[model samples]
Target: MVFTPPQNYNEIKSLLENLEAYINSPEFHEIDSLIKMPIIHYQFESIHPFYDGNGRTGRIINMLYLVQQKLLDIPVLYLSSYIIKNKNDYYRLLQEVRTKDAWEEWIIWMLKGVEITALETIKVVNKIKILMDDYKKEIRSEFSFYSHDLINILFKHPYTKIDFLQKELGVHRNTASSYLNALAKHGLLNKVKIGKSNYYINQKLFNTLTKR
Candidate 1:
């Protein structure tokens, strides 16, 4: 019983119509198509189409649709991170689209965010993978075993905290801290002081993040 956008989105069932019709159509190259994804995303959020996780759901749909249309090879284009960084402007831009006919500005901002996000994500992913490979070749894990999921999480959140890993991997605090410290001791993570907490973000990953 998932909702689906109808034929004429602006007319009836606009939220569902806009999303379903656009995805079902072969209109990926058009500017309208490109703009439609985010527009529908904004409208979906504004309409509060779902009762729970509406914002996150809409955002996930945005990335999924982009890759569905073959515009992105991977779901690495995360505008949410960018929007999260500039929350005020994010809402304002979307509001302008709903209020005025300022398609140009909205599209411009959306496209720019897409380009910046895609390239930035690409850089980070590549760098993180490279560093992970270096770890495998240089420092082998001690006795017993470890999970390969570590590399995946490291790629997702380069600055992963011990507490976070403990929760994720279902390990004790000391074990989590040890894993993090191991990564750092082996010259993988660079301990950074962000305000109060000491973060063990991968330095090689940070290099990618900070590199233009």
Candidate 2:
């Protein structure tokens, strides 16, 4: 269904300005963050200020708002994945808000997304930590060039290159290449050559990130 947003440029402009003010308003500050965010998200989406990227921008605003409230140390709790999985419900609930004034259902849906996303993020973080520890022990036992910095560099960039290691570890090109090659040879990294450049893939880290 096609929803008609505000068509007048001046009206859209004013609504967007009001949204900015509302977010920083004392009335907004009085509401709990979990409650306030969904309301703000609805307001932004309804305003639909931009022709494109409204959904993406709204999600970003949700994260930023959480950070601004000091509820998160970083803006890592993303609801995009959850929304993607339940896109039909997301759109339906949003439409219901405009048509039937279904604020409760919309707020509940958003809150549930927040809860599920937060839990999933925690699980992913724990998995990464365990994988990093395993890599540390195995690489230290097998390789002479093992260091905490090496482990960090490998995990920090799932698709790592010799140039990355060279700059991060303050090593020469040959030295970085030797380290990456050794890891690839040991089956710790899968080395793929793209054109003239080689990228060492941390398969476990890549899987962790891309896993559904």
Candidate 3:
């Protein structure tokens, strides 16, 4: 389907000025940041300042605002999944606000997205923590020589390379390869070849992330 942006090209700068004035105003800060977040997001999206990447920039601003307002210790909770899940509703609500000045509905929808996404993110974090604990126990039992830091680095991403292990552990390439191979043997990682390079994939963590 074709996309309809919230603002006309000529209106971008003035809309952004309005956005800036609102954000910098005492009234904006008087409200609870969480209460203000949806309003800010809607305004930013409606402004549509950039020629491209407005959606992405708007999403980043959401996390940054949380951090700036000290609403979150970390800028981790994301609304992308929520927006993607309710793709049609997301666009429709924005359009409603533009066409019919349906501000209440749009605001409520955004607030709901934030609440739902926060809960889902918390669940994902807890699951990852549990998986990390299990990995520590299994690794310690299987390989007494394995470093906890090494295990952590693997969890940092779904796939890791020998070079990463080598750099982190400050060991030779062969040693890193051997460690990865041992993990693969214990079903901790799956070995995969891409072109001429070998990589160790953290299947459990990968599956957990990709599950939803």
Best by lDDT: 2
- Across 1-212, the per-residue lDDT of candidate 2 in tens digits comes to 67888989999999999988888888767789889899999999999989899999999999999999999999998899999999999999999999899999999999999999999999999999999999999999999999999999999878899999999999999999999999999999999999999999999999997794
TM-score of each: 0.59, 0.94, 0.87
Off by over 4 Å in 1: 1-14, 26-33, 140-212
Which ten contiguous residues of candidate 1 have the minimum total lDDT?
1-10
lDDT of 3 at 42: 81
CA lDDT scores, all candidates in order: 0.71, 0.94, 0.84
- Model 2: runs farther than 4 Å from truth? none
- TM-score of structure candidate 2: 0.94
Screening candidate 2 with a backbone cut-off below 3 angstroms (N, C-alpha, C), the clashing residue pairs are none
- Which tens-of-lDDT digit does each residue in 25-111 have in candidate 3? 887678777777778888887666777897878888889888888888888878888888898998888878778898888888988
What C-alpha lDDT does candidate 2 achieve relative to the native structure? 0.94
Runs of candidate 3 exceeding 4 Å displacement: 1-11, 25-27
Residue range 177-208, candidate 1, lDDT tens digits: 88878778767778777887768886676676
lDDT of 1: 0.71
Q: Candidate 1 or 2, higher TM-score?
A: 2
